[model samples]
Target: MSRAEVKQLIGVKDVARIVLGWGAFAALLILHPLLEPPVPAPVLVIALAVIVAVILVCAFGVVTQAEALAHRLGDPYGSLVLTLSIVLIEVILISAVMLGPGEHATIARDSVMAVAMIILNLVIGLALLLGGMRHRGMAHNRTGTSAYLSMLVVLVALAFGLPALIGVDGSYATAQEIPIIILTLVLYAFFLFRQMGAQAGDFTEVDTRSPQRSPREERTGIRQVLAAHRAEVIVRLALLVVTVIPIVLLSHDMAALLDDGLGRLGAPVALAGVLIAGIVFLPESITAVRAALGGEVQRVVNLCHGALVSTVGLTIPAVLVIGIATGQTVVLAESPANLLMLGVTLLLSVTTFAAKRVTAMHGAAHLVTFAIYVVVLFS
Candidate 1:
């Protein structure tokens, strides 16, 4: 094979994912005796690093491969593919960790909140800043952003706020959590029907237009386009499974390390949530940033808001169900400070996206908010 052909056949991302997954898995298994109680603090730290690295690599591989498939599918569908892929990864990883050998009542809450923070502030701010530098400012679909925010505000309240208000015990009662889960599902389902079905055009367009892709992505796109439908379907289906297993496997080890590491250092419990959020958000974060740089502010909006909404929408229900199945008490309530941050975030999203255009000033505001979130996380 020519060098180019060889490169195509031997995917660095794919191979890295496989190696990291197996390596992490094998390491964890082999070190199980050492990993038991009184485990050296250094060993725990090293385990944390290796497992998180493996999971992160697999995540990026999943995103890269999914983006290629999304390219073939096209928007609405393409965007759906991307958002759902990230949600699936989050669900798998979170579920794995939650089901593992410890209690993690707040993983879902922290992760969803982290996603909301990342989406509304960091991703949006960076996108606006980067897109402005590239194209002097970018325009987004106000209608979709407005609608998304409308649902987002309500959903955030329902998921994170409602629990604190009505719960009987320290956390929510099954009674309270179940209702919130149902409400979130119904609202999100309606939003999907409207966006993907009734008035899909109101949403922003994805800019996977050929001219924007890299030479390799372009060639892959061409191959995807020319391939028989059956072959393409088989490839995507196969790749999806291969990419996800590693993340699910590594999540437990990563969770144990985070719990151990944070506990050892006397860090705030919320820090664990931030780490979970960052890891799960990394894959989608890349695509959103790329969309912003490509001058597709609308796609960036879709990616950011879609992720925020879906993280709340899908995750709440999934977490609730997991709680029911496992007898785990899932807590969605944020601390007072975090609740304030969320309120500010939702409020700002309402006003920022109320307009049709976004600029550097908007990006700066977002970055400032993101800085506050980080500061609070550390403090």
Candidate 2:
């Protein structure tokens, strides 16, 4: 395709990824000589980190563009796009590692657990704690919160809990997984229908107290704003896909580097999972935190719980299919220790949200659970 034709397809936001993709390519050229040499641990770490930083920049661009689109699209759809973009990143990252030569049977499981831990315990906790400190207790819809919590609890139990209680084929059975995968997708679709379709005015509703638009935005007019959002969505969506291809392409190298690096350091084998989890979770972490601080705990819940549900709801099916097609083993259960923490964290989260208001102390409790997760990760 001619640059002119391609140029017509992209907007200002797409320029960010275009510029970054080129910069990353140039950086790789510069690093060719360095990467060719016998790579040292520190040197390899630096090299990998640089590459990761570039990928992260692309991801952040996607998040920014998606955030704008969310503002324009409105909740349910907007929130769906926001969380799905982050979820897509997580999926891409994990799929890359899983499909690589690394023998990480549990990467999918660990990554899901990590995302849930980070969002529920860390992000949710911080949002509530900080917001509560300022507002004491912000009123939310108890029934709505409870509905989301109910689905989440059932899904988590089915995905993580039942997997632990049952095993087959020396690992997670393809037969078993395929049904769960289908059920997961079907159930999640039904949940979305309930949330966005039937129950739109109830639990899944957006905050009526939406912040006012800027004077500039007000003058832009609905048609103009939608046109801009549409253009941006098209351009950035393409760019986001283009940007992620490289991240996936480079996953083999990243997998090798991480495997060797972590192995050499005598670190926990799970550190590789943590690295991917941390990288993928970075954008949502910022958004979730911001939602909390803005007295938008519902937004925070939507982002956090939406992420958690998407992780288990969507990722399991995708990962299972990949694992089965590639003839690779897949593991889905957490350690007993992690399972305990996850159960308690889920329990605490639902309990806290049962009230029409959440307090800072509730946030602190979740953070404590997060701390415990970290300690378990290393120990």
Candidate 3:
């Protein structure tokens, strides 16, 4: 009814993202026949560029809406919403590729590994580096960070490491996959229970020495905020879902183009995974870095570590189930180089978070490790 209300409901940029994202999806559907293979190289390049651009726009739109909801929801819950929204897009993209007409047995594995490396090392590294430089040192909830890392260690080992050791090839047997799907889901469910219930405080920023709000008071405050912005929250939530649909619909087209383009270019196969990971997480990475710079170190941890946890906990099972249903052979094992990188990353993360305060020096270590990952990727 008022100017402020109108502005809060939706902005010009939000409308632009929705229109462009859907417009691109519509164009792809109509021009599908013409865009099919044996197409001209120039056309393929142009199509890929346009589609990727639109997807990026939609991704940022998702971030915008997620952040709005997050502000209303508060920490942990807010971060969870943002993390899950991004991961949903990721899972959709991976599933689209796996279901497409190709032997993409390892797309899941590649994408998951890429996500881990990018989020854990590259994004977190930059966040801490910038935050530390600006603030000298940043404080975060050690218990929360430790919980995330511990769960990550177990999930990463189960998803990427153990398969290589035990499977005849590079994946679990059909029998093994069944139980794994259940176990992974169960563990993640338990984690959700603790994270949202009894242990929720661990995931939030709190001054331990200072007095704190009672949980009931905190809940009441959050409720008041949400109630006041109910209309805005609903609008943003709807827009977030609307924006994500186009990305999901366009993923098949993108995957086909990507596979063909890479084959022609002779680029490394792993690069496809890297690109997908980058696209899905790029917005969140920016958000995390901003949080770090603002000295919201715990929020940064929630965005980065929380994201990877969901990526592994949810994605592995989704792909495994997809593999089982489609009769596709899904490979989950990492090469020796990647396995070593994972081990080092987990160890380094533990050491970094164990400290009382995170400093620029810790960030440097992470960046160096990420550099090695880049080298290994290209080499």
Best by lDDT: 3
Best by TM-score: 3
* Candidate 3 residue-wise lDDT, 144-183, digit = tens: 8999998999999999998998885898999999999999
Q: Give the residue spans of candidate 3 off by over 4 A.
A: 1-7, 33-45, 208-210, 214-224, 247-252, 260-265
TM per prediction:
0.81, 0.79, 0.89
User: How much RMSD separates candidate 3 from the native structure?
Assistant: 2.7
Total backbone collisions, model 2: 0
Model 1, 57-159: lDDT tens digits are 7777767766676566544445666677667767777787788888888878877888788789988888888887888867676776788888888988887
Candidate 2: give its CA RMSD in angstroms: 5.6
Q: Point out the worst 10-residue segment of candidate 2 by lDDT.
A: 214-223
Residue 107 displacement (Å), model 2: 2.2
Stretches of candidate 1 exceeding 4 Å from the true structure: 1-16, 36-59, 92-102, 173-175, 206-230, 262-266, 322-328
For model 2, which pairs clash? none
TM-score: model 2 vs. ground truth = 0.79
lDDT of 1 at 28: 82
